[model samples]
Target chain A: MAVASARSRGRLEHPRRLWVVGVIIVAAIGFLLAKGLGSSINYFETVNQAVALRSSLGTTTFRMEGVVVRGTVHQTSRGTDFSMRSHGVTVPVVNTSSPPQLFAPGRAVVVVGHFARGTDKFLSNEIMVKHSANYVAAHPNRVKPGANGSS
Target chain B: MIITRRQARRPLTSSSSRRPGSLVRTATGVVGLASVAATVWLGLWVTPPSTNLGQLVRLLYIHPPVAWVAYLAFGVTAAASLLYLWRRTRSVVWDRLAAASGEVGVLFCGLTLVSGSIWGKATWGVWWTWDARLTSTALLFVLYLGYLALRRVPSDPGTRAKRSAVAAILAFADVPISYLSVYWWKTLHQTGTVLNPQRQVHVHGLMAWTLLLGFCAFTLVYAWLVAHRYAVEALAERQQGEGLARALAERRAEGRAA
Candidate 1:
């Protein structure tokens, strides 16, 4: 009935109306998607960059990757405090929960959190340790509750 | 009575036992099975654990390709939609293709999300995050799901096609955002190591081969599924059309009797 409908609906008519209306609705949605991104987008920054622009960064959360500095970690039942360093710049990170198994010092880690206003301290809600591809158990005690180091 | 008459006249309306393309269907099933088998074998057995992620990196072979196909399916939908809207190319076939691709896209999109969540839980110590990549991907999944739902709403074929075309185009706006989320925002997700010029290829040797194989297998599987799903969509459309014709014919006979 495609042919039937086309004939009855007058296939000869111009389709300017449809084209115009579609463009308007689509454009409005696109605009909203773009505009709302500011609140949602969290940029990744290095420790050096985070500190250099701590005043400008304000309350916007971000992720920063660096190697944990040895002897700068303190663990507690309530939370853990550590410092991450890269290229001579070190950023102190305070996490609210037990760090992942590989979160020890001198290992590469990514901290997901934000810096307090006017403070150099980086407060992290989550910390992701860089795991190496070698199927070796770096620490038998620290491996995730159910995961093993072997295939 | 109308259904009986219709079914008798069109025995193949939805029957697959004696489909015209039985050989092709068999071939597709074989290929699909082979792809899945090979992907699992290589991804699990052949490839070494990732250099940094160890066993958790196994998800890479599956996650990336599943996401790739999800994106590919939606991209095909967007292209088909564009063709459907163009006056010179407007046709029910294009609409059918768009509908088929959108459905497949949603399926793969769901798989991608699940696989990604598992990978995240293994590596990131969490199952889900509101990071840009994940959040934008979730949005893409919902948008396409909405597109599928819209297709189900009662409407004439012409209106359905017109609305779906616009919806597909609108939904595709999220694909790029989801893809570029890592670069565009600060997120827990890692940037694309393969495609990004700034990053070097992280996997080498058998790992690279296995990853490549995973991508090829999934793509072939997607093609096979799309071929099957499109045929199903066409059959459903035919049944609807036949039902309408039957109703019209019944009304005409009543008018003559009156």
Candidate 2:
């Protein structure tokens, strides 16, 4: 009976336990390797915190966040600059880089850049806009009246 | 009557075998407590705050370790569930391990999410994003929750174990994908760093060692929790087996009386 029990356990341990252990070991090694090598990975932050610490922010090296203020966007030779309002503060953003498609009025956006000395302006390196939870319509204005030769 | 004579002789054998469990519990508990406390202390106090983020960097103490422990627990559940299914023996012992690991893993996973969000808010200025890694980790959490629910289904033990084993295996697959999603695609979630010895060593001396200790401490706590939960499972299984045996015996007596 002891031999029988041992045999059964041996059979059971083969595919399930051993296979999983193998996978975990391989994946862990891969993960460690990637981390061992220098990788640029940034964590997300919010607008309120960014605005509160604007004075101390390093020039062009930190990230900032706020809602895109209505009619604040202006196209420049390099890219665009806009006033983003968050937590009742207006953050002036200078985007020398292209913005994400979703950037517009009332939309929350995060900008990675550095605050310029004396000007308190943020020179952005990257821009990411947050989309709302509701599924966006495939056509932004499906009911455009007579705009596309429609009745 | 024949079986009773044999069983009476086995009582002494069973009594002598009870020490291993208590010994294991004590050892695991001590190690787990020490490691986790040490990690938390060193991580929060010893590590130099990020040049950029200052004390808000303390969020690293909980986020990475909690994430790692969640992975470890899911691996434990997958292995145990597979073994139970393959053995075809209704060992409630293994099931208990699966259930405990899944629940604790979920708890840690949730903590990782919360701590990560706080860290992000402090660093990036947004609470959440639909990044690849974040989405996958959330899915992984939901999958494990589903695995736990499968165990509670009213069915024969063998059938339930077999059914849950498949889900456990899928959860294991998700672990790697969740970890790698950032690297393989455009993701807002940062790739790993603390576990990489090379990178960790290069980090400012105080911060590196503190985070390392924190990882070790969380691992110990995880092991202790698993062992404690496993013991409770063993006791419950024993009670269940005894109840079934008594029911069977009573039914036999009723037939004889009839």
Candidate 3:
């Protein structure tokens, strides 16, 4: 009789355990969907988009993408100052953070910050280099310094 | 009704007929290793540095191939799970295959994250980011991990296999979403090079060939791993069944003596 009762209890608990696992899996999926899709959909805005929305986006932190205009990069005491251009619109950016090793003129970059108050210059705290999927062999003479001199 | 220990051990013994399967597995492993070595030699020495990415482009040979293998592994898991769920095709072999592939998928997914992180740090200037592609891929890694954990929960074989098969299929929904995340949203990670929707070949010459070799190498490795893992799963299940039978025999013997 005791063995029969224990087996019955075990059978009853089995479905309950599965129910708990089901609830947990559902909850985890919902959390991941909310976290992944909610805030990161618009990772960064283009220079033209940010410029068009400048009035409404005043001083709000956001990320903007544009190519660093040639001959516009300058190292200052605080950081680097450069102008980025996209869609024929240019925005001067004063980045207070050190740029990445790959940061260079004519390279596309995404800067994280906002427009400075009372000035047209964008204040950036971070810079990220962006490269396309296209891969071309570097010319013998055009190879950048310190790039595995074997090439 | 008495059973000897030798009878229990009989199920665990391998017959000589299985030699061909072992030979095939060994051949697959050897070819996989040889190709991986070739990829390393070519990727490091032969392929010229890209004008834009410089020497960092070498990471392309490692990251994308492993990422592709991860996708392939999960795809196999989903297909096997579907087979297990279908009444006509339902069998323990499918369940074992699904579990084996899912485990291997997690390993490759982890390698994907590590290799991608290293590449990101050098090229993107950050070790990590919460962009759409990165986040979705991370979610995928975690989802498979959850599937593996659910498979471990104690239950009767049939119940455990059924539930885990369902979980495997559901977890596979994340694989396509992760792959398409770059197109579905603006992301920091670059778009696909070879498998892009445009089908344009961004890679060329020796560089392209090296990348192709890397894909084939990693795929062979994944196949070899799944094959070995499935054999181990089969052996373990047989051992468990034999142990249960022995325990039941002992109980009956005690009842008869009493």
Order of candidates by TM-score, top first?
3, 1, 2
Candidates, DockQ: 0.16, 0.03, 0.35
lDDT of 3 at B244: 67
TM-score of chain B of 1: 0.88
Model 2: per-residue Cα lDDT over B1-258, one tens digit each: 466877887977666446887577678678878777777777676665553234656666668878899988999888888777776754756777888888788888877778877766655455765556666676677667667655554456556667887778877887887877766654555457554323423345556566676677787788888877776666655666666666668889999999
Could you tell me every candidate's TM-score relative to the true structure?
A: 0.77, 0.58, 0.87
The runs of at least 3 residues in candidate 1 whose Cα sits more than 4 Å from the true structure, single-residue gaps closed, are A2-36, A55-65, A102-108, A112-120, A130-151, B1-22, B197-200, B256-258
Clashing pairs in 1: A42-B186, A43-B186, A44-B186, A131-B52, A132-B51, A132-B52, A133-B50, A133-B51, A133-B52
lDDT of 1 by residue, B129-240 (tens): 6678887887788788778766754556798899989999999999998888877776667777455546566566676667777788888788878887888888877766
Share of native interface contacts recovered by each model: 0.14, 0.01, 0.47
Q: Candidate 1 residues A28-64, lDDT tens each?
A: 4465456337434643577888778778778778778
| Native-to-model Cα distance after best TM-score fit, residue B215 in candidate 3, in Å | 0.2
lDDT of 1: 0.74
Ranking 1 against 3 by TM-score, winner: 3
Using lDDT, give the best candidate's number: 3
CA lDDT, every model vs. true structure: 0.74, 0.65, 0.86
Per-candidate clashes, comma-separated: 9, 18, 0
Error at A122, model 2, angstroms: 14
